[model samples]
Target chain A: MPNNIATVLSRQDTWRGRSQRLPRRTITTGHNNLDLLLQGGWPISVLTELMPQQSGIGELSLLLPTIKYYADNNQLCVWLDPPYQPYAPRLAAADIALDKLLVVRSKNHAEWLWAAEQSIRSGALLLAWTKQPPPRYADLRKLQLAAADNGNAAFLFSAPSAMSAPSPAALRLELQSLEINQLLLNVRKQRGVAGGAQLQLSLGEANTQRTNLALLPADRHRTYPVRQFNN
Target chain B: MLKRDIWLYLHFPLLPLEALLPQLPTEQAQKPIAIINLQKNIQRVLCCNTQAAAWGIEPDLSISTALALCPELELLSRQIEQEQQLLQQLALVAYSFSPVVILTDSGSLNHSSVPSNHSSGLWLEISGCYKLFKGYDALLRELDYRLRSQSITAVNGIGQNPLAAKLLCGPDFETQLPDQTEIQRRLLNADLSLLEINRKQQQSFKQLGLNTVGDLLALPRSALSRRFNAELMLTIAQLNNEKPFNAPRFQPANSFRDLIQNPQGIFNKESLLFPMKTLLQHLCQYLMARQCHCREIEWHFEPLIGESQKMQIQLSGSQNNWSTLLMLSRLQLERLELPRSIEQIILYADQFIEAPMGVFNLDLFDNQKTAQQSCELIDSLNARLGIDALSQPILNQDYLPEQASTLATPGKHSNTSLNKKLKAPQPLWLLTDPAPVHLRNKKLYWRQPLTIISGPERLCGNWWQAEQQRDYYLACDSNGARYWLFRETSSQRWFVHGLFS
Candidate 1:
């Protein structure tokens, strides 16, 4: 028996152990600098966690471009229990196809989780965004497993308090507002790569403002013609 | 042209027993049990299980005597109304097999002159349905399988007409597939007691040495009619397929309504599930047979001691799946607190849509099928939660930032249709109501000092109702929180409207 086992092990093409490879397909973050910082872009067919430092910090704006890309390709984008009502004019300004967007608000946590699980398992080329409390390890694992076969992406928005706790998400990032029309992204965890990378992104043209005024030479106390906005 | 109609008769020998079997626990089913009914002062047994029969107990025996024979017997009083409801439910099962199903009881044959003993059963005309079901044999096999699946014990018989079919379904006719000639032979060999005739007429037939139907048929028709009566002559003609009698066919109603009366009343929420599931399953089959779907169902819970409460569930789309309906109802029931014990539950449905005939795709990889399944999931959630809980943002044709957009119902309309024509960039999150901000010495205050990035986008509207004017700006506070602020030109007051993020 030992000799037969040795013979089988000596075969030229016998598969062994687990495979270590990464998914090649990715979705760009619409910011070239941030995309480069993440090594291509956010990988598709995985769960990505986005933790905002506080409410209204350009968190939704960060994902709008990816959402619009999918919508233009005739794919669905679902939002489960958004904190505030999505304003239509801004979505249109971002070139998002509203017909492809679905918003579901559940009455309680269980219903919200059920809707989220079902959306990921639907197998559509889509993206699902959900704002929820910090879920337990088992629930996150379930979503992760469901996303593996989803052939798309899912973004989970949670409070920054979840940073200290462990998670099963493929990628985890904290989005912070550094100044007006500028955001800082801190990657806390990611699959197939080391974490702890800070990247800066500039806002869109509408968010940027330019004003001209009379100017003076340097070292001379004077109000010169300058572009006045957040650094 | 007299058509030869083939009829199949189904006799449920144990419907009374089977109807109450589901209510019993598994351990109690193997024991001797008998259902008793009181007639004038004597408690007579209406039906008994095989275990009771083995203990020398049978139908029509006095309850006391049966108890004396089997000291450990279990007894339950018979509810006649429940038996009638079970008969109606059985008729629905028969309707699935043939379009023309007739429910037969003792007095259903009211036109007959004779007083024949007839048990309750179902009759179906299968001449036209044979080709669709491959053959009569295959159809019978399928019918038998379905009956046994429900734990019902039935006896079946086939004949050229309904009369012959019913008479041939005796206690010994468990599964008989007789042809036309075979049916004639069986009917002739049957005893004359099978006919519904007066006692005097039956005595005379026996006194004349006539034993079987064949013995009476051998005599001259006119002489027999003279000996018997005109009704007997008609019966004979009908049995032989010479006279065609239209058995009133049972037609399904356009809407569904059912009431389940549990005399003991449902004590807890768990007990209500049993009766609700039964009603839902029957309703699903009823709708499926008609190729229709219902959009809403109303449930009325009638308590024994209080005013009845009604709960209605509105579906996002038309549906007929029994399990899904059961699940949604379960969620609703779980959240309810009963005021008193519920004695009866009534379900009603009226709005229906014609369903297209198609095979359901069960494969998970089928994109359209999965999408449909997800839609159903959303509907189930909305049915439990109010429809207002789910919504999408849509563009409104107003100038005010607060009124320019609103949340519309999900899946009801295209949310993007109006947004495409808009030209302004609105904030993602708007305040529920504008909060007044303080501005002094050309400096904005929002819990801290704020700096203006740009702005003075002037707008005005709604002059017919209440005139409004404002200059909106984009600003941020020291904490890096961007806000949308507008100053009312009339009052010179500043208010926050939205957040950029």
Candidate 2:
């Protein structure tokens, strides 16, 4: 009986309890504690869903390090249907190569999905946001397959309400902010791992302040000479 | 020892009729058809299909006579423009086999029964290329197969000189050539009527008892020059390889333009894809032959009832592959809603760039492969969506958040450096226009009540233009959403500008 059990365990398709024999490839998430909570870092070649409770909650800041890593490696990073213009100076300040970054705005849901699928199939790190008439479950499955085939990471952002909906994403995280620059991440789904893992991360500038010298009374009323035009 | 040159002549006897046959309906194309031209104020038949000839209506017959012979004969006026275009297209096909291809319109030299604009030919210098195709037989076989696939009827001839090649191309001429002496013997027996000389010259030859080319060659050259015209002497010199036959080398068109007509009128937009694919394949062949790549292609669709519609498909990068181009064209066509049935489709591409050498490289580790894939994805997206749909974020050196960054077309590299001197962290998303914050009961309310976290970082610049002064802050709403807010010191009004996410 012991010999039979050993042979069965030696098979390549054998599933082991409490541990994964083939761990997924990952890229660091820039935060040590969050990386540790996710078991190494953000998974590669799979869909990772980030559902933030609201906008402006350090969600993009969390992925900044990974995006920077891809851009630095001369790989393309595509942003599809972002809600607002991605401030280039901020990304540039984060050391992301602007030339390697593509921002695609699709006119309709179908175009958006097509662009997302094409981006994933091209092996580019895709970061897409769900808009009106959100993608169906089948669309996400297609994207997951594309990501798996291309061996690239694709991150999808949706409203926090999507946390309860079924998703094909390999990793699903519910994001909320405890305070300014402080993000709380609850792992809702993870393949081959237990769910309900949570971590808190301090994201942007923690303690930095600059005096409002430009708004002082003397500068408030500063005036400049107007240029004269000849007729 | 110097090797002699070998020339191949392809004579298209019914080019005028064949060029216009593709534009006709299936039923109309099968009936008796004849191409007629005005000769001395008389409508004379230039060329006719076998169906017409079966009714005893042959070339040089008057139109009235032709009508009498075959009352159902369909007479079409000779189209000089179409014939020229078809000749050029054939020259391009011949160019694929040999580098030196010469296009000739032998309408004037043809028999009086088949006058000018009725026949055309392409001469290919094949001595250097036959070996590349393995042998002369294989080369000729391949050429014949290509022409046959296009429904082109050509008379093929081979000779040591261009004139001999043309003269040897008879209705009963054999493709297989014997020794040089046999070829000479055949050339000697060729009738004087086969020569390009006019009727007057032919009569002069017959009056002098020179019926065969050998009979004329037997006469003294000085005597023949004194008796015959300069044109006859020139023809003799060219046939004997004494004078060089120098015509312009065929240059493939810099741009690709081809037209396809559907008399049945394609009603469904999807049906247009089949014909569009064929045109794209031809365009790819043209590009490959020229070693060039095109970035834009204009598709003009002429409908039966409405004005012609034009759709342009522009690629982010120059591409010459048929599959890629066809895919892009398909994407573009899917979005086009045709108002009427399409009668004709003209594909034109003028902008061409030399294809890079690395484009054909199959090296696994070639870094350009990834870049090319990225460009292809961008092109595919842009084709389905508008060109403005895709862009790259570029940073600018300025103080204002809106002025510090801008959107540029994809693939544009930015060289501007961010102002790192600002210590405060910048927001990830910025609104095109700031939203005003409501102050109720002395509390900042933007969707909800806001609580200031830490800011008051002043970003005051552009004083020379609009003279602006504002105090910026980092604030959080009741839902824990961080907002980049600012208060105009002059107006004492507050607005939200960006999101920290």
Candidate 3:
């Protein structure tokens, strides 16, 4: 291969055809089915746009495992303009370190994008959400470049309407509720792979065990076997 | 064998003019300017610029004579305070070269060669610092370059002690010093007027046929001790290195406070950037010399009219880098609105703390470096936006969802632990205030009719306050969007409290 071509191909952001795929670094999504669908897991050091059909529907739950992974390893996690206040107890219960988490609320669209880009460039796991005045294509591209340069994962949450427009995100997934405990993920776009792949994942079971254990009274303790008096 | 100390003295011949030149307008600075001192009701010229000197103006010339010599000469009264401040600033520069720096008091030298109004001088003991700066020549060159960049002109001389160094510092001083024997030879040939003696003593020396230091040294020690006073004898001993010269070392200020005045007034906000950058650079240099970091800096802008406006920039972490500080200050200035034309700008930073070792690292895998970068980002964001824009979620020991968690300053660790046993999963997003849900057709409706996927988890708390008793449920809308809903038992009102996302 020509030296220039080789150098260009060596870049992490460069995508090749499936027949000559390059191995990329990724963080496991903690779900076997989703990981299988993503080949390994969520691609690292790139933008991942998660467009849910509506609010909730287990959208944030899908990222809880990834956030916990980074937070546990002492990496910073920045949340830009989250829709509502992040429930601390829920995050703590999921074993995510609160100290490693930074929540930033920007006053305007420009500041929001600036904060998102800065967070990504700092090599933090960035989770940003777009508001009524959605970010433009150029803004998302800037964020994508920052993530690729810093080698950190950035997940952007936007309305489902964004799925119709093209984006610079390496991975674009449309999330929907398959059932109360299950979520359906449609791969709208992905790098170096064919898109339109769908996967139904059961996310409710992970928290169901915790909820059941929590239903038990706080005073409940393991019973000790009574020793009969020496007859 | 004992090693001899090498001393370097910096003499500022035109310090009074140079000290105030930065504040003058360009057009005015280009004209011939002279600083005058009043002694016994007689005003005499103390220092003059090259333009004034070209017109026959010299130190000790009467003001009237100087004016007659050049009608365009601009006379300024001597500012002792400004001269002292400039000396301190110069000392800071010298301190960077060597840890031992001494500041000479102005008007302290009574020698005929030294002017009565000559500003203070700086003495640096550079014997131990030769290797650090490669060599004495390189050290001198670096010091000269730094001073020139600040638009300051200084003459330097080298000797075995402070007095000898001061005597060697004249218009004929050499940049490269000679060997010890050669230095002694030059000192012997130096005129007696260079010694720290009054005019009467110099006249007495002249009458006694003592023209050069060699002539005086050629006399008997008993005759010299009997003829000269104690001060002159001590000065001679210090000059010969037979006696040690003891002076207090210069200590850098603990805080940084510098002011830049623009006489013409800065009408545009963008015009303040240059002065702001200069001040920040000096501040960073001061912090580096002190081996500390400043967490907050306050900028006071004195307008031509009205009260001065104050802007304080706070950093999430301590910083000592000039470019970082300048960038942060620019971001803040972009948002500030000046009330009137700014006449002066004062930068003050008093809260300094010792910077942690290895605050910057090149290792890609270092966790501390990553944390520091995150801190820098937080600071930038907070500088442009408000400080309250950034926060970290912290859990509180309370049953109510709103009370269970609150936002705190970033990096603040909360001591409240999660209630492990209260396992009903909380939504990831909680509304600041619950929105009431409407009931239509006897079904729960929030934007649309909702279906309850799970039952009530009764939570009752805040008995001391307006008590709250609600039954929480997980519900989904027609579009499969899930929400956290609750119904108040007393009011029978259903509301949407959070989202699972």
lDDT of 1 by residue, A1-231 (tens): 125766544432234466344324566555556656665555666788888887677888877777776666555577877776677777777667675676777766676677677767654333334445567778888887667655467888878888898988889999888986688889999776799988877775555432111221122112211122221
DockQ for model 3? 0.51
Q: How do these models rank on lDDT, best leading?
A: 3, 2, 1
User: Over the stretch B261-355, how does candidate 1's per-residue lDDT look in tens digits?
Assistant: 76567788888988899889888878876778888898999998888988787776578888888888887776677647888898998888887
lDDT of 3 by residue, B414-448 (tens): 67777566556678899989999998989998887
Q: For each candidate, what TM-score against the reference? A: 0.80, 0.86, 0.89
Classified by CAPRI criteria, candidate 1 counts as acceptable
| Docking quality tier of model 2 | medium
Off by over 4 Å in 2: A1-23, A28-40, A72-75, A205-231, B38-45, B48-74, B106-117, B130-132, B170-186, B207-215, B363-366, B411-422, B440-443, B477-481
lDDT of 2 by residue, B1-501 (tens): 677778888888878889899888778999999999988789899999989989998889999999999999999999888887778888878888999888765322333433444447878888898569988777887888888887888887777788888877866324564567877898888888877766888899888988888898888899999988887887788788888886678888878899888878988878888888878877877887798999889999998887898889887778988789888888888888775789999999999999987677785663677777777888888888878898898888777888778899875666877657658867889987989999999999988899888889888878764436778898888667789899887788999989988
How does candidate 3 fare on TM-score? 0.89
Chain B TM per candidate, please?
0.82, 0.88, 0.92
Best by TM-score: 3
Q: Is candidate 1 or candidate 2 better by TM-score?
A: 2
Worst 10 residues of 2 chain B by lDDT: B106-115
**Residue A177: error of model 3 in Å?**
0.3
Q: On a 0 to 100 scale, what is the lDDT of residue B210 in model 1?
A: 94
Weakest lDDT window of 10 consecutive positions for candidate 1 chain B: B110-119
